[model samples]
Target: MTCALIYRGNDILLCRDENDKLSFPVVDINNYDNSEIIYFETDGTQYAVLPEKTAETIAGGVWRGLRESWGELEPKTWNIAAKGAELAHFMQTNRFCGTCGTALVKASDISRRCPACKREFFPSLSPAIIVLVTRGEEALLVHAKSFRRPFYALVAGFVETGETIEECVAREIYEETSLRVTDIRYFGSQSWPFPSQLMLGFTARYASGRLRWADGELSDGGFFTRESHPLLPSLPSISRRLIDAWLNGEIGGK
Candidate 1:
C-alpha cells in the first residue's frame, strides 16, 4: 500500500542494513514536494521515483541496476516494481506533448493526454523475437555486439512493423548468422523491462546455411551441442530458458 520504488537515473535504490537483507527505503511521500517527484501505481501499490538528489540522501544499500537487484527481490515483486520503474521513465520523458509542446496530464493509469492536441499516449512495449535454432543435437548461439559481456544467447531481434513474429524470427536468424530455419513455433514469452521489451520466445530447426557473423551486428556465433556449450546469458532471461529447454531435449524433437 505504502511502498515506493525510489530510483536514481537507471538504477533503483536498494538498501541492506546491518543484517544485510535487501529492501527499498521507505519514504514518507507527503514530506517530499510533489512537483519534484514522479509517482505511479501498479496492482494497488504506490511507487515513487525519487529525485536523484533526494535518492542520494537515503542511507543503506547502494543504487543498483534492475538486473543486479533481481536475485535479491521476490520474482512477483520485481516484475510489478519493474513495471512501475518503466512507467516512471515513460512519464519523465513524456512530460510534454511532442506536437504542441503542451504539458501532458495523466489520462488513465497507463496513459497521458495532451489537452491542446487531444492526443493520448500510452506506455509502449517493444516486441522482440528470440529463438533457439537447433540442428539435430546442436543449437545456434550468438554473441551480439551490444552485449555487456561475452556470453552467448539465442538469435534475437526486434519485430519490425508489417512483419509477423515468425517472419521476424526467420529474418533475424538469417540476418545474424546467415542461417535458414524452419518450424518456427512459439515457446513462451517474458516481459523484459530493461527499458521495456516483450520477448517472444520460439524454437526453430536449422534448414540451411553455415554460421557466419552479420558483420557489425554479431561478433561471433556457432552451432554447439550441449556438451560443448559456451558461457550463457543470465538465467532470469527467457533466452536462457529457451537455451536450457533445447539442452534438455525439450525442443528440436531429439
Candidate 2:
C-alpha cells in the first residue's frame, strides 16, 4: 500500500534485488517513522519521498535519469514515480511562504498552505504544444537551439497566456520553422514530467511558406519524406510517437 521514491540529485534510486529484478526501494510508511517526510497518494496507493541522505544510504546504485532506464520501468511505475519526484521537488522548494515569509504547512495531499497569509500553493505544471507538420508525403522536423544532441524533433513551444492550443500550435510551427500550417487536428497527449510538462500533440498540414529556421530558437529544419528522413528523437516521447505515426502513414492519408 505504501512505497517510496528516493531521489539523489537528478538521478533516482533503483534497487536490484537478489533475484536480479530491478524495482524501486518501496517501504511501508508506518514501518519507517520519519518526521521530515511528505507523503502523497496516486491511484489509491500511498507514496513518500526520501530525504537526500536517506536515499543515498538506501540506494545501491542510482540511475542517472529516467530516460536512460525508461524501457525497464513499467509505465504505471514511471508515472507514479515521476509524480512523486515532482511532489518532492515542490515541497523542497516551497519550504516557506512567498507572500508572508512564514513557514508553510501541508494543506492537503498535494498542496501547501501558509498559516500567516492563508495562501495555498500547489504543484506547478506547464503546458506545451508539439505539432507534426506534414506536406504531402513529407513531415517537417526541426532542430532546436536547446537540444543537447543533434537529432531533430517536431516543432514545439510553451503555450503563452491568452492563447488557444490551436493558436499555440500554429504560432510555434511558424515561429520555429517559418512555415504556415492548416488542418490542425488533435493527435494525442503525454505527461512529460521531466520537470512537469503536459505535451499536447497535433497534426497539421503545411499551408504555405518555405522551410526556414527562426534564427535564434531554431538551428535548422526541413521537410523530409519517409525514405529520406534524418535522425529523430527517441521513443517514449509524444514527439516520437507523432513522428512515428507520420512515418508509418498513420497521419497523412497515404
Candidate 3:
C-alpha cells in the first residue's frame, strides 16, 4: 500500500476519516491496473499522483484546493500534497513537446522526454522574493489588490530575467510601494507551490520614501508596530514567519 495525492483539476483529494481528521487519500497504485499513475519524490518521500478522471474509479475522499487544505492536513502531509500538485501541473501541462509536435513520455521520476527530439522537460520553478522591511520598531505591510481576504502581507514579487534575487527584492519593493530599502539580507525560503513558486524571504531596513502604492497592485499599505499591525497571513505562509520573526526580536533589528 502507498499514500497518494489525487488531483481533481487544480484541487487535491483529501480523505476525511470518521473522527473528522483529514489526510491524504490512501491509494494503492497497484490496484489501478489499467491507469497511468505518475510518481514523484520530494524530500526523499515517494508518492503517486493521478488525475480526477482516473481517481473517480477509486472510492472516497473530498477534493480541496491546497490553500484550503492547509493546517487541516498535518504539516508534512500538506507539504507532500503541495509537491504532488506541482508535479501534477507539470504532467498536465507538458504532455506535448514545445520544440516539436510530438507527445512526451516519462524520462525519469522528475522529467519527461519527447520521442522525436529527445528534449527533457522538468517541473518548472518560479522564484519570487518576499521581504519584511523594518523601519525601527515598525515593519512594512501591505494589502495586495489580489488578496481574497483582508489580511496584510509583506512586499513580494517574482524574479525577472537578468535580475539577481537581491535586485528583485529592491525592484519589487520600489515598484509596488515606492520605498527604498538598505542592508537587504537573506532570511529563509519556502516552497510556495501555488502551481510551482519558490518564495525566498528577506529582511531589510527602510532606506527612504513615504509609502505610495503603485496603481492596480496594492490596495493599502503602511509601516506599523507589532501592536498596531492589522490582520496578517496564516501561520503556514512564509510571510507570517518573516513578520513573526521581526516582532519576536529574531531579525530586522539594529
Candidate 4:
C-alpha cells in the first residue's frame, strides 16, 4: 500500500480516521496499473497521485483546497501535498518540448526530457519579493486592488528581468506606494506554491516619500503600528510572520 495525494482541479482528497485526524489515503499502487499517475518519494515515504475521476470512485474522503486545509494538516503532510500538487501541475503543463514538438519523457522524478531535441526541462519557479518596510515603529502595509478581501499586506512584487531581488524589493514598494526605502536586508523566504512561486522576504527602513500610490494597483496605503494596524493576513504565511516579528520587536529600527 502507498499513501497518495488525490487531486481534482485545485482540490486534494483527504480522509479522516476514527481519531478525526486527516490524512492522505493509502491505496494499493497496482490499482492504477494503466493510468497516468505520478509517483515520488520524500523523507522515506512513498507517495502517488490519483486523478479526480479515479479517486472519486474510491469511497471515504472529502476534497478540499490546500489553502482551506492549511490549519488541519500536520506540517509534514501539508508539505507533501503541496509538493505533489506542484509536480502534478508541472507534469500536466509540460507534456511536450517547447524547443521541438516532440513528446517529453521522464528524465528523472522531477524532470522531463525531449528525446528529439535532447532538451531537459524541470519544474519552473517564479521568485517574488515580499518586504516589510518600517519607519521608526510603524510598518508599511498596502491593500492591493486585486485582493479578494479588504485585508492589508506588506509590499511585494515578482522579480523582473535584469533586476536583483534587492532591487525588486525597493521597486515594488516605490511603484506601489510611492515610498522609497533603505536598509534593505534579507529576512527569510517561503515556498509559496500557489501555482509555483518562491517568496523571498526582506526588511527595509522607510527613506522618504509621501503616500501617492499607483492608481489601479493599490486601494489603500499607510503606515501603522501593532495596535493600530488593519485586519491582517492569517498565520503560517510569511507576510504574517514578518508582521508578527515587527510587532514583537524582533526586526525593526532605523
Candidate 4 versus truth, CA RMSD in Å, comes to 1.6
TM-score of each: 0.91, 0.92, 0.92, 0.95
lDDT of model 3, residue 38:
74
37-116 per-residue lDDT for model 1 (tens digits): 66666676677766667765576647777777777777886786588777877877788998999999888757899999
Candidate 1 wrong stretches, greater than 4 Å:
17-19
Best by TM-score: 4
At residue 42, give the lDDT of candidate 3: 70
Check candidate 2 and list the clashing pairs: none
Task: State in Å the error of residue 69, model 1.
Answer: 1.5
Better of 1 and 4 by TM-score: 4
Clashes of each: 1, 0, 0, 0
Cα displacement (angstroms), candidate 3, residue 124, comes to 1.7
Comparing 1 and 2 on TM-score, the stronger one: 2
Best by lDDT: 4
Q: lDDT (0-100) at residue 83 of candidate 1?
A: 80
Model 3 segments more than 4 A misplaced: 17-20, 33-35, 42-45
Per-residue CA lDDT of model 3 for 72-112, tens digit only, reads: 88888888888888888898889999999799998987789
Error of 2 at 47 (Å): 1.4
**Lowest summed lDDT window (length 10), candidate 1:** 1-10
Least accurate 10 contiguous residues by lDDT in model 4: 29-38
* Model 1 TM-score, all chains together: 0.91
